[model samples]
Target chain A: MEWIIIPDKKPDTHVEHIYREKTDKRILKRNPWRDVRLHGTVLVLVIIAELIGTIKIPITKDVAITIMPLIYTIILGLAFYLIKPIKWIHRKQARIAEGAMMLFIGVLIAKLAISSGQSIGLIFEMGPALILQEIGHLATILVLPIALLLGFKKEAIGMTNSIGREPNVAVVVDKYGFNSPESRGVFAIFIIGTVIGTIFISFLVTFSLSFLPLHPYAFAMASGVGSASMNAAAIGPTLAAFPGMETQIEAFAGFSNLLSFCVGIYIVIFIALPLTERVYDWLEPKIGRDSIMPEKEDDNNA
Target chain B: MPDLIDSSENVSVHGIFNWILLLFIFSVITAVGNFLGYHHPIEGSLIGMAILSFITLIGVWLERYVPLDISSILYISVIGIIVAFPGMPTSEFVLKYVSQIELLAIVTVFLAYVGIGMGKSWDEFKALGWRAIVITVLVIAATYYGAAIVAHIVLVLTGVPAV
Candidate 1:
């Protein structure tokens, strides 16, 4: 929490000052890339080891069932460790790392669960299944504050310091004057247009897909493409409710997420960018450029 | 100096109390959802967020009568947990599905960053004229269609079962 404020300072320290500071005998220098590479390599080795160990051990159905949760817990723990620093450093990078970590964790857990003799269907039915069916849910209310306190402390001191700053565009937008009726009308139109366009596109995709002999996986993928969090949450209940389609649904959800990841960046840049620009342009002419940057005029006159 | 000290003390107390309240609210929502058999983790989270947001709004409204500072610390913590949890499936699902979600999250964050970076001031955008507006609309349309097409092809080729 405190680290959030570090970037607000106007550092008088130059590059030379930074270099000199780095050279100080008391200051321990580190290569972040090197650290990342080492961690990556270690993670790879651990994954390989786990895979080989699982395959080599002739796990009985009962044993595999018990080991499944334990393995998942371990992997989850490892994922937390691997992602903690990255999450702190860069949220985007943290996501990538977390994804990889999740994959490994999922595999280890799945393998353990399957080997332990419990049907994947049963686990789905009893655990997350039951949890999902309950609509009016809250996390265990008592433990919430402790968890939040720990998170704040961790974020403040950990990677929060290194995360990049917000872009300047937001500030300018906030400052821009768009009080005129015409400008307001244009702005409203733009929002409505974007929403309508998005909805139309979504509908089209759904309609076209209706013709195919697509798997439930495809549906899940569609859901993911439509919205990641929504799809992710739906998977448990969807799987549990329709037990026969669990594996395929799970697979589709995974693939859909991957596809969305691949496309989301390009879509935002290529699609959202222009739309935002156009809306601004339409409003600007009506509002007048001078009104938008009154501060700039003042500075110029001064 | 004395006034500043007094204000800072007040702010800290306000922050602490707010966090405690948030914790209570989040726990109650999640617990009730669990008890009621709302298995959709995402829905549970949404409920939690909605409740929190409502609470914050109400608190802000009440601030006219009483000086109170909402603690962002509590909000962030709850969000982090919500994001991190629900991926707690039988390890296989987590392994397969979680990574994909992670990748999606990364892409989303990256896109958001790009959007923020490319964002124009209201004045600048206004000055750019109708051509800019047209371009943005086209781009949004094209991207959505393009992604949809790609998804369709992938799904078809993979022989995914129809809903």
Candidate 2:
């Protein structure tokens, strides 16, 4: 959230200090190209993922969900990084990879944008519906009462303000300062969302396909909730579910996601943030507790 | 590592060139994934990559010089739309080759970077506590399904048939 990752343990090296201090100049200087180990690791992960191919699990007799290479690569790469003794990835290399992720995402956007253009007719046809679906982002406020019931205070405001992407983090930091409980709330959720949101959305969309009676196009439009990876994850399984609808699904999702990237900042600031504050003020006294998240080192189950 | 410090510290030149290199690298890698996963020919994938990368670079260029606060994605999307909007001269050529490269292939590459990047954040993730994790999931679900439900209603109202 700080564009810097603060470690739990004491820092020892200049690199660690630079990271903790968030020296953007020094941080950006580390060449992404120098991380050859990281690049080689990705090449292998891609091969492994593609070779395994797509696997379908029948959730029921009529409806089956599938996992593709997209899911496999992420799981395999995460496993490689988390295995500890592998030492295939250093913390610094991971940071460089994070920076590279932003750059690599451009190809995807370009591809999806072309697809969006190809289906411009459909996008125009569903323009109102596609735009209105973004109002669904406001539904995040639905969690405010639930969060309060579970003992969160103002932290719920930050958690529910937006989907906690980088720009949303900026909004919270600007308004509430980095050290405030609100920023803490936003940061925690943002980190988790980045790390796990893709896999979670992929499964959620796949499961919803079996039971939800909505048109697949609606699901496609809804899939574009700002984050590119999450949007891609949502669209991937939807494409698998509706085999012939690839162009329309990709178009709707891409255009909707583009809207979010452009309009999402203002909506979050003027509408969602204020709405969350008022809702928290109104609902906190009615169904809230004074409990804070316990800072416990014992539960290292993440 | 000379490449690390070769360029000056200015974000415009150094950052832009680095961004281009990243696009090139990813494009090459994605071509391989397209061949393996989607069964598209590597040559076809590479051609598609060239077109996509060109559009992306132009968009990035416009974003830098346009003196507007709009996101580079908007420029990219607009350029893409113009170049492939059915009647444009380039539309046929653009769509033909680009379609050969499956979206999932690029997605596979993108997420691989995301997963590896997430490695360093494991400790920070663990420290978020169970409460934050629960709330994060709920928030994600609400946004996703809530949007779907709204779109579903609109579609029904507009008489767009459900699939």
Candidate 3:
């Protein structure tokens, strides 16, 4: 093998220019508050919403728990849609915005863990029942036929993760390169869900807890689909639904979520993804499209 | 300090100080919000949030060592719970407030950020088209109901009281 020993010299001007062009300003500026106004607006809204929720209001507890998040979520989404036309969210802001949710996840989980610590015995006692709730994750298979029906191609396999947690996403992204259409498909759902999943989960879980024959504990365990934010989202309202079992429910949910995170990847790789493939092939001619995205349009997008 | 924090603009971010400051302030401010929202003992919750913030900082640092996806929250959850109370009350404070503070308020802020982030990717989403919407809705439905189904069967099998 021939090794070339090159001089340790600075890049030429053209090379530097080419390199600079590829780099985003966010890499250079690193302004924490470049997007502060927009970020601040959201933060302020949350605080106000928090106050509104805690203080007495005319709305009944049932309506408030079920619909409050949904209302704020829609308004916020509309605001986001409106600002997009004006280029309000630039690359740096986009980075912060994307990361903002996970930032608070620890705090919420920390609280849940504290409750879990108190109810550790409860977790052990409810072992098999708690473990069985993970079977709900098997429902990701439902997306198979739906994605195909909606004209998804092979990439629809990426959409099988119902939890939208980082681990499940990692499983898919690792299998299919980040630039693959499959990754893009999963990423889009992940983003959309992160933006709105909490509200939807809160509403749906509470409603399900009301009429479903299953105990609130079942939904609590179900909440632990590997994502802290989603767990918090699902568990918060369930706590309200079963005010007395708040700590026990969170304990079960937190531990179950941890279990899910540990086992989620294997299930996705060995079971879920392959199952989706068979279903994809079986239904392709009847429902699948050529591709989710037009050819190479986002080839450069990561 | 600002210059130091934002000094590097590359593939990897190198702003430990800024992150530390931001995270500390975030915990404190959110703690205050929770206090106002839940009417929990302000002092206890504040100290708890501070300790948890510090623990979270440790988790952040620890992430560099642990290559896996799990970090921050759960890692801190276990440590915080074990070390807290009778010793520091960090865990108890959090446990007290966690139930009462309206979680939607906390969630909406993050969701709003995600919405703004999605704003930047409107084209990508547009390219994804209606199928993205259909796929997301259907997947969520399947996930929720599927879990409920499993829960139903489990309750029956274990002979646990349903609801």
Candidate 3 Cα lDDT to native:
0.59
Question: Could you give candidate 2's per-residue lDDT for residues A86-174 as a string of tens digits?
Answer: 78687766777776775565677888899888999888999989888888789999999998998888789999988887678778877
Docking class of 1: incorrect
What is the lDDT, from 0 to 100, of the residue A236 in candidate 1? 34
| Candidate that would win on TM-score | 2
Instruction: State which candidate, 1 or 3, has the greater lDDT.
Output: 3
Best first by lDDT, ranked: 2, 3, 1
User: What are the candidates' interface root-mean-square deviations?
Assistant: 21.5, 2.7, 4.8
Task: Name the top lDDT candidate.
Answer: 2
lDDT by residue for model 3 (A1-302), tens = 00111126632211111122122233224445445665565656566655666321325554433545424543564465556464554654655554544455555566566666777766767777767666678797877877776666756777765455556656666677655667666776775565556556666776676656566677778877676656666776676667667667767777777767666667777877787778777887887655546665343222
Estimated TM-score per prediction? 0.28, 0.90, 0.77
DockQ for each of the predicted structures, in order? 0.03, 0.56, 0.40
Clashes of each: 51, 0, 3
Candidate 1 per-residue lDDT, tens place, A77-139, comes to 334334545343233222223222221222212212222222234323323222221110111
In model 1 chain A, where is the ten-residue run with the lowest total lDDT?
Answer: A156-165
- Strongest candidate by DockQ: 2
For candidate 3, report its TM-score. 0.77
* Residue B52 Cα positional deviation in candidate 1, in Å, after optimal superposition: 16
